[model samples]
Target: MYPKLPSLMDTRIPTFLKNFNLQAFEVVGYSAINAKYQADFCHVSVKDAVMKGGGRRVHGWALWEFESHIVGNFHSIWERPDGTFVDVTPPKVGTKVIFAPDASLKITDDGTHQTLYQNRTSDPGLPYIDPLGNAANHPQWMLENSNPSLIEYCKSLGWNNASMA
Candidate 1:
């Protein structure tokens, strides 16, 4: 039998927050996993256009462990249940992915930076966040922008969501 994988909530979340000096935030959404492939990791293409003139994009077959707990602009956690967070996105290149919730909070805390575009209309009840842009939205972005071959690969793996799962 396969070993039980650790939960992202129990492991990676704390380390991600502590590493970046961020406060805990709610999990917004997540890609559904197929029961048969529960322990297997999938590759996803994440777009990092938030930094430096539309930014560069990276494509690879790295195992993706996604969690949406933290409130920010990042899409995937790239973290293993073993508490290792990998930044497979292009923003930091080879560095580990860090959620900059503190930076996001600072913008929201400062009223002057407020703008309607920054606030997510999907969930109106929540406080305004991501004055710059939220990486949290990137998974969907990746799905929307992904090629047909990648989409087929994801579907074959039982990623049922319209977006990458």
Candidate 2:
């Protein structure tokens, strides 16, 4: 059974510092100007935009929906001087993205970005431990709740903790 996905209003969202606003932004005219793999370098793109002109960096999470779960990946976007937010990174597919701004989250030195995963359905029959965004620190939780593919992906990254029982 799948765990139900939490909305911004859900009290279960751990460390959810603020309401996750549903946002849709346009990719800037020069989004791909200096970006290599645009989709993978959102932080860089936003940073470059801020450096080039007059805009502040906005930190938040970008939500990606999968069949089994919805993942919220820590991300950054650009807020123009006019107070309008825009994604300076070229999206991999569609022009739109689901973004949630969290003023509290920021890029850190560890280089290990955080991601939150929530089940698509709330099935009480299943073991419904809430998914932690920082699975790298929770080996046991990773083994139990994370999908097999994700565990394998972690292994490829040399995350030995994920391989532990």
lDDT of 1 by residue, 33-104 (tens): 223222212223322111212333222212113233333233333333443334433331222333322333
Candidate 2 residues 7-46, lDDT tens each?
4444323322222333332223224444342565565456
- Candidate 2 Cα RMSD (Å): 10.3
**lDDT of each candidate versus the true structure:** 0.31, 0.47
Candidate with maximal lDDT: 2
RMSD of candidate 1 to the truth, in angstroms, is 16.4
Q: Could you list the CA RMSD of all candidates, in the order they appear?
A: 16.4, 10.3
For model 2 the local lDDT of residue 159 reads 52
C-alpha TM-score for every candidate: 0.25, 0.50
Q: What is residue 53's positional error in candidate 2, in angstroms?
A: 1.0
Highest-TM-score candidate = 2
Model 1 TM-score, 2 decimals: 0.25
C-alpha lDDT (0 to 100) for residue 54 of candidate 2: 78
